[model samples]
Target chain A: MKILVVEDEKQIADFVKKGLTEQGFLVELCDHGDEAMERILDQPYDAIVLDIMLPGRDGLSILKQFRKKGHTTPVILLTARSELDERIEGLNTGADDYLTKPFYVEELTARLHAVLRRSSDEQMSLLQAGDVSVNVLTREVKRRGESVRLTAREFSLLEYLMRSPGRVYTRTQILEHVWGYDFDPNTNLVDVHIQRLRKKVSPDKENPVIETIRGVGYRVCKDGAE
Target chain B: MTPRSFRTRVLLVSVAVSGLVLLGFAWWSWQLLEAFSSLSGLDTELVAGHAWLASHLDAVRWFRREFLFLFALGLVCVLGGSWLLAWYAVRPVDLLIDAAEGITAQDLERRIPQRGAGDEFGRLIDVFNDMLERLEVSFNHATRFSADAAHELKTPLTILQGQLDQALQEAPDGSPLQQNLGRLLEEVQRLKVIIRRLLLLSLADAGRIRVALTPMRLDELLGQVIEDVEILAPELRVIQELEEDAWVDADEALLQQAIQNLVNNAIKYNIDGGKIRFQLFRHEENLRFAIANTSEGIPEEDRRQVFRRFYRADPAHSRKVDGVGLGLSLAREIVRAHQGKLWLADAPEGWVMFVMELPEGAGDGAVESGE
Candidate 1:
């Protein structure tokens, strides 16, 4: 995937560019706002990482202008301020997603992939991890082709993990996505639910589909039951 | 002597001055009455010219009676007029006292209303409002500085965390270097958390808190919190008695942060393998949530100081615990923003309990008038 990163700070821009480059994406970096706008108008890229507080132009205006011109490329916003108005405004101005600063690049990568996948034509109706499958529309969970009954909360947890198998999610991320919490409670809430989920789905503690990365968090296997 | 109110002081001064004027008038009038009596004799000699002027004596006696009546009326007038003067002097002072007492640190923008006094009182109000203006400016400056510093700090933190995370991924699995990198990454994450929290606090300090309120079941949220606590501290005995349909319109994330901070404190200060109990119920128009745990006792003096920013009851043991001493303060701020009250409750001996009282269905509003 080709991506463009526009940030004024040299170190941050370089770090992000290098990270995205190492992740096998063609990343074009721009430091100045006018120059970034010039490049954005010149060509097409899969995604753009635009910083809100840029020198030449603020991210919101750029987004507004870009959207006004009718460009449909998926763009993710990076902002230093966690102000709600800015987040809502950015979303209203055609941003696919928003990430607050002080975030890990892996998180950015994950969000980028998620945004790209969402913008693609193929919409995911069913998500699967080996024998366990969750139909997003019907809200059904099946283990080994057998329909498994689960609580609404448990179903949401399973669906979130199954959507991005093999991608480890931190507890904070899980809390934010699954629990719809904007702030981290620093509790082992994800662990408790995942345990109950493991019992009902895999039932085998030794070869569970949900894997725990110690000192990290939880993830589902990309392919399981080997 | 008991301290008098400003109104009382002004009234006393006015009464004293008026009383002294009334006494001086009475003394001068008594002397004038005596002089008028002497004038009756002179009038009889100059005008009547008759050796027999007994009627002049009777007229003088009548004048003495009328003079006494007039003096009595003057005394009554002086009393009433003095009371009115006292009231006039005290009214503005009473208003100034009420307005001054109502002012809080959060509302430096508030000014005493002008009543066209054009006196010392008005100047006092103007001076007071000017001082408030300066205070607001300085306060805004301080808040903006911290917010700016926190904002600037994020880029560096993001780079550090991003690079460290990347290096950790490149290192071999289970290698010592990777483990070290993981530790470094955690520290970076901690820094990120501190900065985020600091920014939030700065917003709250500036009374610019933004919150999106939604109606949700408090019982359900508490159940989830307790479930997490059970996972983390399995050794501790936990009990929860939550009422059904205990709902509140609040910002979920903010309320959760407040509750989690309280629970974390309960666990942190608790004795090893101690018991914790949580209660949720509706009282009147408020929903009450009480969480208690068996803990090392707090001194009587320290109990009041617990909610103070960066207050640690036992400084020596603070290091043994992992916290930045902002948990309770932040929790309290969040609760206050929700128009709720959170306080350290008077618990049974050997227990530390916190009581959170929130109105059952408060509408969405800024945190402590912030934002």
Candidate 2:
């Protein structure tokens, strides 16, 4: 899948492009909204991660232009503003999904996957990784054909991690995905819950299906036994 | 009569009385001259003795001139004395009027002095000075609030940019950069929350936050708050004593925001495994909702200031809980806008309790707004 990242800041733009590329997706970067518009007009991208604050043209205007041109490609808006009004404005302006900036790449990746999956023709109700399976429709989980009980929070965390296999997610990303808009990363809730999910979903707790990419984050290996 | 404003009333009365006296004296002098000329017997006798009268005419004329001169001198003395007395009586007040006109919002430091004689103008000056003092304090508070909001927003943005710059120092592989990028995103969201809240407050300050009043059940509102907080902090136990069918006239959205702020604060400040108790009740023409939680009791001095903008009781100033001190202020504003009162009550057992009271039938949009 080809993705376009429209952000003004060189560092953030490069980071997003490089990260998605390593995940084996074709990536394109533009420094401003106008540049993004010119590039997107020529090449059809699978998705676009657009930042709200951009030079030449703001992301909102660009999003409107794309929608005006009848492009229905999925667009996730990144903003540093967390107000309800701003969220409403972004969604009202044809943004498919909204994520506040300073967000974890993992949650961004996960939300993008979810948005893409949701936009796809057929709703794939099950998200599977190795021996564990998640029922997206029913919000249930099972491992080795045995039912495993998980809290509402645990289910959300597992679903977020399982969506993107072999991709590392930081504690902050996990917190944002599992806990709504009000999580304080200073707390140890992320680590505590990761341990709980390990007990429920991993075949052997010692040799868990979820791998901890130390000093980085946790990831579910795609090659693990399914 | 009732020790009325002497400077205003006395000055008006004096001008009216002086004008009437001058008009009355002029009319009386004219009446006397007409009566003397109309004395028929005296006029005929004076003409008959014209030769004798001519001999004394010069002396009579000299006496007449002397009498007129004396009368003119007396009138001048009386008018001049009254004018000086009136000016003396009203001079202090004229000084005060000039001073009052000079006072403005930007220069609240100007004061009318009680000039030590302890007169009425002095009392007015004292009151005016007190008002200015209060105005200066509130103005400073508002300025500080905006400055603090800017600082809060900038700090997180700086961190996010710094992290991204360092992570992508090389040609980005995306994995190592993604991890740092993720942290940066979280901070940005936090910054956004603070900004949104600050904007909410500013809109409210501008008197532009339109609250849509609708009939709402307090029970459902409190239930939502408890359930949301429980999901966020599962370790805490929350108990609700909501009166069912407790209908209230309010803007459902603003009321919800106020209640959420109260509940969120209680959840954030409470001890681990602590219990939160929420109650909604109606008492004699007022609807009251309160939230109580186990907490380190605020100092007596701090309690009064907890609702102040950007105020935090924690001395360490850690950004852990993400408070810009705008929540309580916003809650207070919302409650006040609903024609209600918001306050923190002193609690026993070192607990903190926040109470909000709304006047019955207040938000029917019929209540006269002080705005």
Candidate 3:
């Protein structure tokens, strides 16, 4: 997928570009706001990663102008402050997601993948394999038509893994996704939580779903092997 | 001695002065009457005025009685009049006291309303409001300071973090270079957390914290917290007593963050195999939650400092207690921003306890909030 990155800080922008490029996405970089707007309008990319503060024109103003004109390409806003209204305002202005600054590129990549999948997929809120069905919008999980309850954290962990099934995620990636940016990476929090999820979902049996990849991380079985 | 009221002090001083003046005038009148009565020709010349004395021919005795009667009546009038005047003079000050009591640091806009009569009290109101304006300016500066510092600091941090993350990925798996980068990145992550929390605190300090209120279930939140506690501290026994259907209005994320902080701290500081008790119930018009955990309790001197930022009860500032820094302080700030209160409370020896109270709320929209 092609991605457009608009950031004024050249060094940070390079880092983002390199990260995305390493992740195997073509990245087009623009440092100036006016040029960024022109480039975005010039041609469409699969997704856009935007910075709030920019030269020539600010990110919000650009978002406003293009969104008013009905640009449908998914956009993720990158900002420095997790201030009170900035996140709400960005989402309301048609941005799909918001990430605070000093963020891991992997975190950004995850968000990019999420927004892209949301745009492309038919059922963005539902993950279904075998007898287990997960509903994101309603937050309902059913195993073989019997309702299964999960705590908030469990639900989040499940949703993150189920978003892209059959894909292995490392411990650090799981920590960033499930806990947050500030969670202690050294702790066995992810392992402990995953264990809880396993016990709750499949008691008295070796769980076919939520397969743990030894020395790597965990993944949801696409085939839901018994 | 008991502290005296300003009204009483004002009344006493004025009454004393008026009483002295009135008594002095009565004394002088009596002395003049004595001088006149002792005059040889006065009894015959002023007989009509001294008729009461004419009956007895002992005019001084009759003058003394009548003058003493007049003195008592005059004293009563002066005393009463002084009291009324004193009350009137201090009425404005009473209003001032009432207004001043309501002006807290969180609300500087609540100024003493101008009386508009350009009197002493009106000028006082103007000056007080002016001072509040100055205070409000300083408060706004404090709020802006955190956000500005975060903005300036994050750019370089982002660059550094991105480079480090990139280098770590490039480094071979489990190599020493990778280990070194991992450690550096963790420190950077820690700095980011500190900065974010500091900003949140500053916003709360200025009473600029923005909360989107929604009806939510504290029991559900507590249930989640319990699950986390179980996973994080399985060796520790948790005795939970939660009131059914007890709900509270909160910003779900912020409130959850606060409660999680409390739970995490309880686990982090507790001795292995310690017991934790969690309780939630409605009290009066508030929903109260209390947590008691077995731990090496805080010293009396340090108990009050638990909610202070970066204040570790350990004197050495020792190897940091794991988790996000300033757990108690941030939790308190979050609770305060919700118009709730969090406090360290007295507990049994060898245990620490905290209580959080929030205004009682209904959970009518809880299910619909899932959208």
Best model number under TM-score: 1
Q: If ranked by TM-score, best first, what sequence of candidates would result?
A: 1, 3, 2
Assess candidate 1 and give its lDDT.
0.77
Q: How would you encode candidate 1's per-residue C-alpha lDDT over A1-226 as one tens digit per residue?
A: 8999988888788878877786678998988788888888899999999999998888888888999999988899998875655666788788999888877665677678778878885555677787788887789888889998987768988877776566555666676667654444455677778888998999966667788777666778877521
Chain B of candidate 2 versus the native chain B: what TM-score? Answer: 0.54
Tens-digit lDDT track for model 3 on B185-299? Answer: 7677777777878888887777767776788889988987786677667799999999978878788877877887788678777887899999998899999999999998887
* Chain A TM-scores of all predicted models: 0.78, 0.82, 0.66
Clashing pairs in 1: B207-B370, B208-B370, B208-B371, B209-B370
Q: Choose the strongest candidate by lDDT.
A: 3
Candidate 3 iRMSD, 1 decimal: 4.3
Docking category of candidate 2? incorrect
Model 1 regions more than 4 Å off = A1-5, A14-29, A34-49, A61-76, A82-97, A106-122, A135-139, A149-200, A203-208, A211-218, A222-226, B1-5, B30-99, B111-123, B314-321, B362-371
Backbone collisions counted per model:
4, 10, 0
Kindly give the stretch of ten consecutive residues in candidate 1 chain B with the minimal lDDT sum: B362-371
lDDT-wise, the better of 2 and 3 is 3
Among these predictions, the greatest DockQ belongs to 1
Residue pairs in clash, model 2: A19-B174, A82-B192, A101-B185, A102-B184, A102-B185, A102-B186, A103-B185, A103-B186, A104-B182, B114-B122
- Predictions in order: lDDT: 0.77, 0.70, 0.79
